[model samples]
Target: MRIGLYPGTFDPVTHGHIDIIRRACTLVDRLVIGVAINRDKGPMFSLEERLAMVEAECRYLSEATGTEIVAHPFENLLIDCARDVGAQMIVRGLRAVADFEYEFQMVGMNRTLDPEIETVFLMADAQHQAIASKLVKEIARLGGDISHFVTPTVARSLMDKLGRG
Candidate 1:
């Protein structure tokens, strides 16, 4: 089976992320959404919350796309996570050239860590290219409407968590 690892903090899984997930599913037989435990980011949502949201969002993707997409939380190095999940490739979403610079270095390092593993970059949909989790959280915190950027469930959760609701 061709398994791909799409790892991210996914603090609130924005539409941009959903876009990447949908697109990535087309390239792999099995896609594992690895939610990283990056405490450094001081996530608005807990790991469990983030995982739950991702699970709910991606629940139908497997059935619809014919790709088994599962969400897993990992604290180890991404390469280690890939190995643990038997992922042959790592899927990343690039919103702009700025994303390429960072992702380019990341893939290079990942390749060094595990030469057998490969990384594939998928461009974000034009409409979603500007949607980012950080920006979404900031917008929600400031009482901005995020319904357009995220699913209704996530939008409500963000508002409740940020005291904007």
Candidate 2:
């Protein structure tokens, strides 16, 4: 069975994220969404809260896309996570050339770590290309409406975190 890993902080899963997950599902037997535990980046939500939100968001995806969706929180190196999960592919979403530059380097490093593993990049839908967790947080922090960028559950969670809900 071919398995792919999509790793991200997923501070809150957005509609764009769901779009990519849906697309990745079409190409892989199983897609594991790996939520990285990045201590460097202070997050609005706790790791446990983030994991639960992702799990809830993905439940609909499993049914709608007919793909197995599994959520895991990882603190180890991404290559290690891939190996542990038997993932032969790393799936990423590219929003712009900047993303390409970063993802390119990451792909090269992952290849060096495990030559058998391959990284695949998918371009985000144009509408969501500008949407990111950091951007979402900024908007929410400033009391800007983000209902259009994130899923309803994610939007609600962000609002709750900002004490606006």
Best by lDDT: 1
TM-score of each: 0.97, 0.97
Per-candidate Cα lDDT values, in order, are 0.94, 0.90
The ten-residue window of minimal lDDT in model 1 covers: 156-165
Score candidate 1 by TM-score against the native.
0.97
What clash pairs does model 2 have? none
Residue 121, model 1: lDDT of 90
Candidate 2: tens digits of C-alpha lDDT, residues 1-165:
989999999987887788889899998888999999998998888899988998899898899888899998899999999999999999999999999999999988989999999998999999989989899999989988899888888888998898888
Structural RMSD, model 2: 0.8
Candidate 1 lDDT over residue span 100-145, tens digit each: 9999999889999999999999999999999999999988887788
